[model samples]
Target: MSGFWGVARAIIGREFLRFVHQRERFLAALVRPMVWLVIFAAGFRAALGLSIIPPYQNYITYETYIVPGLCAMVLLFNGMQSSLSLVYDREMGSMRLLLTSSFPRWWLLFCRLLGSTAISILQVYTFLALAALFGIVLPLPGYVAVLPGLFLGGLMLGALGLVLSSFVKQLENFAGVMNFVIFPMFFLSSALYPLWKMAESSPLLRDICAFNPFTHVVELIRFLLYLQINWGALIWVLGSTVVLCTIAVWGYDPARGLMKRKS
Candidate 1:
């Protein structure tokens, strides 16, 4: 038991140290979402009118509504960034070293996911703090309440990164992931706009958005932040996390991994 905790702590510490050294990465994570909130959302607020959506009893400002989505955006980007680092580690052979350690592979992978999720939670809170400063405040309890949703959402996204890194053989090839996976996941989801709005435009697109895992991630946060429960969103997030994590672990398995080909 102690050994498991010790290894997890060491991995988490390493992740934190890497984050501290890369100040720009932290800044970039916050900047992308803040830009959307402060600039783009302001212009769009007047153009797109949101009705009283679930978890929102009254019409809300675009900034206020998008907070959870932006929070998920922070998680999404940071998750990819963490995966980028994994690709770097693989190219440099550090991943093999870490994997070959005495610790069980699943435990080690869990630690990695946990570490990334922890950093993501910190970034989300910092973003929320800035949002509050900018006059987009939620209920005081909402701040505390959002933690689990953030952690779950972060874990799900980070697991996704792990799955992608498992398939991608090189660092340079990640651009395709950004183009195909990241962009679609963000834009097609309920992150920036609600599904009813999409329905007004195209019912098919609205149905597609409903199936997006990122959509549930955002909705989970939105409901938790507003002190509401969305059972559908919760089930979607939980199911997706389980499925993604299973795939990630399988991808990294030596027998199932590219290592079998190389060996």
Candidate 2:
């Protein structure tokens, strides 16, 4: 038991240290969403007016409506950044060393996921504080209430990243792949606009967005930030996390997975 905890601590500590050293990564993570919130949302505020939506009893500004989605954006990008590091580590042979250690592979991967999720939570809180300073504040208790949703959403995105990393064989190829995954996942979801808006435009596109796990992730955070719960979103996010984690474990399996091909 002591050994297990020890390994967990070590891996998590390593992730923290790596994040600290990469100051630009943190800046980039904050910048992308802040741009959307401050500049893009402002321009679009008049262009895309929002009616009162669920978890929102009154009509709100575009900035307020998108806060939760931007928070989820932070998690989504950070999750991918963590996966980028995993691919980098694998290329450098460090990932192989970690996997070959006496610790179980799944445990190691879980620790990595936990570490990334913790960092994502920190970044989300920081973003929320900044948003508050900019005059977009949620319910006070909602700040506290949203932690579990953030943690679960982070894990789901991080697990998806893990699954991607296991399949990507080289560091050079990851950036293009990330763009392919990230942009579609972000733009197609409820992050920028509501699903009903999408439905108004095209029911097929709306259905696609509803099927997206990232949509549920955004909805989960959005509801929690209002001190409410979206049961459907919660269930979808939970199930997606389980399925993604299972696929990640399989992807890293020695005999039957991509790791074998890499080895």
lDDT of 1: 0.92
Candidate 2 ranges with C-alpha deviation above 4 Å = none
lDDT of 1 at 110: 92
Q: What is the C-alpha lDDT profile of model 1 across 1-263, one tens digit per residue? A: 99999999999999999999999998998888899999999899999888897899988998998999999999999899899898898888888888999989989999999999999999999999999989999999999998999999999999999998888887889888767888999999999999999999999999999999999999999999989878899899999999999999999999897456434
1-263 in candidate 2: lDDT tens per residue? Answer: 99999999999999999999999988888888889999999899999979988999998999998998899999999999999999999888898888998988999999999999999999999899988889998999999999999999999999999999999988999999999999999989999999999999999999999999999999999999889999999999999999999999999998888778787
Candidate 1 colliding pairs: none
Looking at candidate 2, what is the lDDT of residue 56?
95
Please give each candidate's TM-score: 0.98, 0.98
**Lowest-lDDT window of 10 residues in candidate 2?**
254-263
Candidate 1 off by > 4 Å: 261-263
